[model samples]
Target: MDWRPWLTRWSEEWIGCTAPDELDPDVVRDGWLGFAPASPEAVAAAEERLGTGLPPSYREFLLTTDGWRDAGCFVSRMSDTSTLDWVRDLEPYWQDWEEPDDEEGDAEGGPISRGLLISLEADAGILFLDPGDVDESGEWAAYSLFSWLAEPPTRFPSFIALMESLYAEFHEMRRPEGATRDSWEAQVEEARRHALAGDIDAAEPVLAKAEDFGLSRATVLRAQILLLIGRTYEAEQLLGRLLHPSFTPDGFFADPLFAEEFLPLLFAEHARSSSPGHNSILQSALIGDPPELQLIIAEHQARLRRGAARATYGNPEFDDLVHAALERHATDPDALWRAVGEALPRWRPRSTDHIAPVALLTHPVLADTLTPERGRALLSQPRGDHR
Candidate 1:
């Protein structure tokens, strides 16, 4: 899609919404958000100098505006044709840092050593386009490398896609509702409130949208929603992205809902799958936990070896309940699950936040109870009203 109109709109909205202190003095004085378009000769010179043709979206961007201000919250300026150069030439030291192997679908090293640097000023990050990985439409893969991000550089399909994501991040931070893109933070809060109240159906879509806007917590919330609807595999896949050997149950992880509900669901999935790919995730995650948690993992592993393994929710009380339910040996697991679901709300946590433990609604035992119609009814009901 042509980004000129949207870019112009984004610039205007940014100029209108940004505070005077944050706006560049020149921008405020001139009431202009971008530089004059680059001449064909200038564009040709950069392409010839770099020995690779510039991608269409970026080339079109230069034709629209040779340079741009506030490309994102951190990028103070975008390179004009005159200033654009290869990342290797501009920052050769980038090649010295060892590139990690690709995890999941994340690209290795982000091609930083072989990319076209697009941004002129990056306060804490750099934006580059990888000409080596082009799509059918000839748009190069774009990357946003941030200093604080522990993982590989965030990749986009094209320059336009990268710019759109940056713009979305801008909207997420500024919350300029009714100005450009919808406010992702607002959507996240709305989804959180709904999910906590046991309205997963209502919350799921908003959470999904917030996830698209780079809200990490939204992924967690959406995973819970997926679990509530009995989509255990999908939920497991989503949570897998967030899980790492070094994951700490601190900060947001310490939240009562996340600690009590989400973690258990993830651990349960790990035990059930025991796939070779994720075997190490469980091993690394359990290291340095409380002695009780360690014992649980050890016992679970022993049971797995004996071919008599059972899923545990990672909480002692809940595990006891699960053991009791299994001991009953009722012919119908669904009936047993329904009983467990009914008791979930009363399962108190170690934390003070008495926000209804909706996370328990995702227990593997209760999956059978979350049939489409029943799941919708269960999730739509207010907290404490689940049958």
Candidate 2:
């Protein structure tokens, strides 16, 4: 794929953008959001010096612009042709990290010790491409590693794919509304409305975008939508991240729908999940909380100790449907979800006496069962709290 258009668009969008002190002065002087393109001779010399053919996509990228600026939140500079070198040459001890078994390489040394280091300036992060893992199209697999990430290094199929994802992160940070606080707030509210009206397909993407920009409300709203769609696993994943130790819960739980209705259901689900360390994660989130919130947390803990049934929609009608589903299809999880499909019309929103929370969207399994009339009924429910 052509790199010029992508780089041009990124540059155009980043006009007057300010970054950390790691920002390269060359980026500001070039007027292209990148340094001048490397000459064919310079590219050839790097290839000869490295003793390995550069991947096509990255080579094309270098010919377009020798290096990049602000590659991602942590990676401030992409290495120029002159600076490109092997990871082992720069950070030999990186081999101390064990390699993934599935990958074909030195049994002990992974991408960090075997790959080409492509990033020049980063905040406790490493970006590299593994030539040994080249695809049929000659694009090397790229890895983004950061000290703060507890998970394995994030991988992309190719150089451009990695760059595009980084560009998306950049856009998330500098939205068209111009980086002011709460720029994405309007989108979150609109998405909440869409989710309540049973247009979850419309709502989810917006909520996901807002969540990417670090809004706790968006994360909560999106997780509720995930649960409503019968995506219990996905919802729990979001909940796990939302309650991560680094996450602050200042403005969260202020919404009564979240505090009163959602938290109980979340705790009940946590009880059923029995995922290791989740209880500790929950307790960690409650540290330094006000007395009322502490009481609320204690109540959920007590209920879990008493072996409370896993809460579904917080409405008796819905819980009954879920219980019936469990009984009728004890051997087949998909069948139980299908039963949820059949129960959508009978399912009432827990907050209906007031207004809807994201809990109103019928499960995706309910897709086949949602007639136009049923869809309208789902959409027309009252939503959210008086406050």
Candidate 3:
């Protein structure tokens, strides 16, 4: 198939504009994101060195753009025609299963031969053509090898077919829906870096700019910033809008920004809230803490089930103790109770002891496991009285 025109159009449409000097070795020697067509002489030299004619589509691709950067997957710049020495460089590493295996004394069984065609440095993998696995047109079968997997190589029909598959996958990752300008994406990335570094002051301004452009990701980041600064009410309100059914109707929960960043903040804020009603807001919104935290809470409730437990509950420092107790008491209920008993001696006489523990007991996981009688009994325990 005439792949040159198609490749050119794809490059222009997806890869964006290219300068005339982009193809110059000096220009792209450091790095580049697109392609530069090679001379016919250069292609001929590579073919002569490999002793196999390049696949028709790949050959045409080179005629249009000699090598590309990140064509698909983690593939770096394809080897320019002049630097086609990877074939020779990788010969020693190739296992010739055609011959008998001297170590195992087995002629038929051993590591199979893999003809390496392209090496992807960042991905730690290679694209190869297997002579033994050819197609009707005499094109070699293409395969991919990765150092991370012990299984057999993944196979494809031809180089062009492999490229096509990679392109499709790359497009999916770009999230073409509601596409934004490259500049907008860059601004969002910069904002995220600031947010991650705990510099909300710096991040908010940049995110505001991206939000002005209607970038949904920027909204998510802003929600994260709000949560970080202890603005749970505002964060949840914004998230409700950004993640509303009408706004992100299709993949609201599945968006990585939501799942990885926003959701965790929501769960943590719920965990930290002093008001049972405020904490319940998350449950009413159908948001739950992660399973690990839920499991820890369940175990804590089990200990509370055993007997009366003591904890200092009326101060800000007690919040830290509540978080710590939830994590520390799985098998050693005695230690947890002892820690709480130790804190009680320092508790002020008028301080409310029931609030934090009662709040915890009312968590959905715990509340569901305990009968109403049992829950009320645990809530009535007078362990916090110093007398």
Candidate of highest TM-score: 2
Q: Assess candidate 1 and give its lDDT.
A: 0.67
Report the lDDT tens digits of candidate 1 across residue range 1-387. Answer: 675678777777787889888888877776667878888889999999888888888998898889899876888898899889888788766554326442224443447777888888888678889887899999999998877775567889999889888887776556454533446667776777776577776788887767655566677667756765667667666665555322222354545555456655555656666766646445555555655446655654576589873444434665567557656734566766665555455454344322233454445445544575555554554543222
TM-score of each: 0.58, 0.64, 0.39
* Clash pairs, model 3 backbone: 37-66
Residues 1-387, model 3: lDDT tens digits: 576655544454344333445444543453334456778888898988877677666677677766666665566566667655433256445453233542265432332343645543437666666555567776666666655665456778987777766665554344333234466678777766554433556667887656554566676667645543445466577666664433442444554334333444455446766374564434544454445334534554476588645432334464456446556863455555445444433332222111113233323333233343433333233333313
Off by over 4 Å in 3: 8-34, 85-88, 94-114, 177-387
- TM-score: model 3 vs. ground truth: 0.39
> Positional deviation of 66 in candidate 1, in angstroms?
1.0
Model 3 gets an lDDT of 0.52
- After superposition of all CA atoms, the RMSD between model 3 and the true structure is 18.5
Count the clashes in each prediction: 0, 6, 1
Q: Which is the winner by TM-score between candidate 1 and candidate 3?
A: 1
User: For each candidate, what is the lDDT?
Assistant: 0.67, 0.67, 0.52
Between candidates 1 and 3, the one scoring higher on lDDT is 1
Q: What RMSD does model 2 have?
A: 7.6
Ranked candidates (TM-score, high to low):
2, 1, 3
